[model samples]
Target: MRVLVTGGAGFIGSAVVRHLVNDKRFDVLSIDKLTYAGTLTSMVSVNDNPLYRFENADVCDKTAITQAMSDFRPDRIMHLAAESHVDRSITGAKDFVETNVLGTFNMLECARAYWQSLDSRAKETFRFLHISTDEVYGSLGKEGLFTESTPYDPSSPYSATKAASDHLAKAWERTYGLPVVISNCSNNYGPFHFPEKLIPLMIINAMEGKSLPVYGSGSNIRDWLFVEDHAKALDLIAERGRVGETYNVGGRNEQRNIDVVNRICTLMDEFRPEHGPHSRLIKCVEDRPGHDARYAIDATKLEQELCWKAVENFDTGIEKTVKWYLENEWWWSPLRQRYKGERLGLLPSGA
Candidate 1:
């Protein structure tokens, strides 16, 4: 099958493109805007593959998106493009709105038109998969998991924009009869992750003996999913999932922010003894405005319906992640030079 994967250069998107091209034997047309976080290096494994093609284009550009869709004539459209960083979203929301909301609208409209132009058999086989996040469900208390039925309570600009896109996907399916499936996933961490995120930032910072900033006592809890596992799940859902249904994908591994950082420190100490007591660099910093206290996903629906389960628990996943960063400095070193792992998401008024 031929697949058009938007944001195919970003962390999770690149994972999907690699999986489809290398494992599934699917022809993949990767369309990305090459934002700061979107690096082509993530797709290095499949860059030269016969089935892989790359296009540097924004999803919001209807002309480019439509032209690519027309040319590729894909069986599936996996939409993963967006401004994803929560801290960055807090500081500048316009980009999030434009890309996540408006970009999604453009993709949906273009895909609908393309689908309508398809013949009966092709239209029946075509699918559009909208990838999303669990943050749209808002903060959880000390307990409970975010199910597909959970009402949206987006607190940050990032989540709000994703929530809007989610609605647009569902609306298109309902009103336009588009073959659409949406999946809301938990926090993804693994190799090729940009350094600005919590896990990568802490890993690089600890290695360099720099201060590790933990926000607001570091109690915020997040369910972590391995990017490769998520890519597999996306392929599965896109192939067999029921149209108009939403699936919640998660690692089923929840850890507090501080605990996650400490785990990284312990792993570093065990593997690279030179980084002694990495936890010593732990420093509590001010929390971002509207920071969600906790987020956990109940992926029972995805598992039971699609037979999908995350293979990596927190311990195994984090160990592999730390090892990847240590061994693959060439991949991340340039990124560090560009983005020095500074703090973001500070409110303008200092609320």
Candidate 2:
């Protein structure tokens, strides 16, 4: 089968593309705008594969998207393109709205037009899988987990834009009978991850003996999923998920922000022992604006319906992630140079 994967050069997107190209034996046409977070090196493992093709284009461009749809003639379209950094979104929301909301609208329209032109058999098999985030559910209380039915109360500009896109996806399915499925996943960390995010930032920072910044008291909680496991879940959902249904994917591993950093420090100390304790570098910093207290996903729907579960829990996943960064400096060094582990998402003084 052929798959057209947007943002295939990104962290999670590249993982999905790599899995499809290497393990699933599917032809992949990757369309990406190559933004700061999107790097071609993420797909270096499968760069030479004959079945994997790359296209440098923006999803917001209707003409480019339509042409890509016509040229690839894919059976499935996995949409993973967007400005995904929450801190970046806080500082600059226009890019997030333009890319996440308007860009998704353009993709939906292009996919709908293409689906309409296909034969009955091809149309029946076509799927549009929108990959999203659990952040759209907003901050969760310490007691409950976020389910597919959870009401959206997005706390950040990033999650708000994603929420808007999720609405658009479901609305198109209802109004135009588009074959679309949505998956809201938790925080993903593994190989090829940009250094701007928490895990990578901390890892790189600790390695360099730089101060590891922890926001506030570092009590915020988040469910962490390995990128490869998330890729497997995405593939399964795209092929078998019910149209118009939303599935939540998670690691089933919830961790407090400070605890996570401590774990990373412990692991780094074990793997690469330094003169002083790695934890000593931990520094409490100002928290981001509108920071969610906690986020946890109830992925039962994805597990029961699609027979998909995250294979790597927090312990195994974080170890592997740390090792990947330690071993592959070539992959992350450039990113570190570009983005030195810094804090983001500060609320304006008066606003």
On lDDT, the candidate that comes out on top is 1
The segments of candidate 1 whose C-alpha lies over 4 angstroms from its true place after superposition are 341-351
Give all candidates' CA lDDT scores.
Answer: 0.90, 0.89
- What are the clashing pairs of model 1? none
lDDT of 1 at 336: 71
TM-score, each model?
A: 0.97, 0.97
lDDT of 1 at 167: 100
Q: Write the per-residue lDDT of candidate 1 for residues 1-351, one digit (tens) a residue.
A: 899999999989999999999999999999999988899988888888999999999999999999999999999999999999888887789999999999999999999999999999999999999999999999999878899999999999999999999999999999999999999999999999887788888888888888888888888888889999999999999999999999999998888888998999999889878768788889888777898999999999999999999998888899999999989899888877775545462111110
Question: How well is each residue in 101-146 modelled by candidate 2, as lDDT tens digits?
Answer: 9999999999999999999999988999999999998887779999
